[model samples]
Target: MKTDSQLQQDVMAELKWEPSVHAAQIGVEVKDGVVTLAGEVSSYTEKLNAERAAQRVQGVKALAVDMTIKLSQLGKRTDADIAGSARNILSWTSSLPTDAVKVLVEGGWLTLSGDVEWQFQRQDAADSVRYLLGVIGVSNQIAIKPSLSATVVKSDIEAALKRRAMADAKTIAVEVKGADVTLTGTVHSWAERDLATRSAWGSAGVRNVVDKMNLV
Candidate 1:
């Protein structure tokens, strides 16, 4: 196992190599397998790039980012313009909900807050800010609100399993209770098993998934 300091150092090195990051302005610290990133960048993309580079490192179990962005380059734009741009990006994306989410901009730094149905929506909202030219950085404070419905959960599990199953007779069994979906069956590889579980997570109204699938 790599020490926290070692992990931090490795992540920093990786960030430096990424063309999207202004490595000199970024600061990284690690403790108990959690990496904390602090620094200022010129764009939201740079902030996201720094965090992603850290995530790719092997020993990083979690991340805590406190990056600031300065959008001094896009001069003369009102705060409303910045906020509206962020909101437009979210609204254009199919996965995100514009009404449920809130976008705030202060001196070019954008903060996003709201509840999304899927983890991907949360990530996509942040990514949209990165593409905007005037955004200095983004603070992603979105929450995941999994729905609570057994029927939806069961349908999600079945759909996920059906896609990955070798055939209809694979002996896969799916059960859903509340927001939890349980899968029990045998698959040829761990990859297949994991894929099935991930598929269930992609569905709406699923809060938790339990996989008892056996790999042979």
Candidate 2:
């Protein structure tokens, strides 16, 4: 196991390697394999990229982000402009229905609300505005429209996991309650955990995914 100091260094290195983040402005602190990032970035997108980079480090078990977005002069715009841009961008995104999302901007933070048939469409709405200039943050409040029966959701998710050759397919338990899914299992790495969660979310009508997976 890596020491806390070693893990901190690894996370810092990972952050620096990511081209989108300005690593020097960020502070890395690790305790018991959990990393906390504190700093300021030019935009919300860079803050997200920094967090993702730190999570990619091997020794990071959990992450806490205390970063803030300090927009540059060129990145500053009125909330009205941000809202208009968000709408335009979402409308242009092929994966999302043009009118499926409603945009609300408050102090450069964008809040998206609406209903979509799939999780990916909701996510696409957020991604469409994440990189826009003057965007300090994004809140995706888009809801997923339920479509399939609970039994069908469970069977479809299990079949998909088996097809993907997930190592713990047999061990992982899928419990469907209404539109929610709870995954219980032990995986060897974060990648496997992500795979299991993705499989659950891919099921039709899945509104919430509760991950109770343990890393071995």
Candidate 3:
């Protein structure tokens, strides 16, 4: 087991190692196995990158982001510009369909709404605009179009878990209610838990994934 200080050092090293994050501006605090990141980043993408970098460290039981986006003068733009950029980017993204997502920008935050046939498309819409100059945050309300049965979703998740060798199918209880999936199980590590959640989300027509996985 890693001590709190050791975990903190590891997370800091990871932050420095990540190219997109400015490690010097970030302050890392760890208690038990939980990590808290506090600082200012140049962009919302950097903030997201910092969070992901910290979570990559082993022994991270939970993560709390206290970081804020402090965009540069050149990085800041009007809400209208942000909306226009978001729309243009989403349109160019080959993975997303045309006019599939509607963008609304208030202040610098971008909100997306509409429907897509797959979870990946919904996520792609957000990712397409994550690097926008003035985007402070994104709320993806683009829902998935449900087409598969609950039983099929459950089976698909189980199959994916088995293929990945993350855990036993029987150990992770997958419950599908409508387009929502609730995962209940014990995962050996944070990475495994993340994989399990992704497996649930990867299923066709899954709208929401509720991760109730306990780490052991």
- Candidate 1, position 92, lDDT: 89
Q: To one decimal, what is the Cα RMSD in angstroms of model 2 from the true structure? A: 1.2
Q: After TM-score superposition, what is the CA distance of residue 166 in candidate 3 from its true location, in Å?
A: 2.1
Question: RMSD to native for every prediction?
Answer: 6.9, 1.2, 1.3
| Model 3 steric clash pairs | none
- Candidate 2: global Cα-lDDT? 0.90
Best by TM-score: 2
Residues 78-192 of candidate 1 have per-residue lDDT tens digits of 6688888878878888877658678888866789998878866876888777567676657888776756677766765676667665453256678887666787887654446
> Candidate 2, residues 75-140: lDDT per residue as tens digits?
899999999999889889999876989999999989999999888787778888999999888899
lDDT of each: 0.75, 0.90, 0.90
- The digit string of per-residue lDDT tens for model 3 on 118-169 reads 8989988988998888899999999998999998898998899899987545
Backbone clash pairs for candidate 1 read none
TM-score of each: 0.58, 0.96, 0.95
Off by over 4 Å in 3: 168-170
Ranking by lDDT: 3, 2, 1
Off by over 4 Å in 1: 83-130, 136-148, 154-201, 206-216
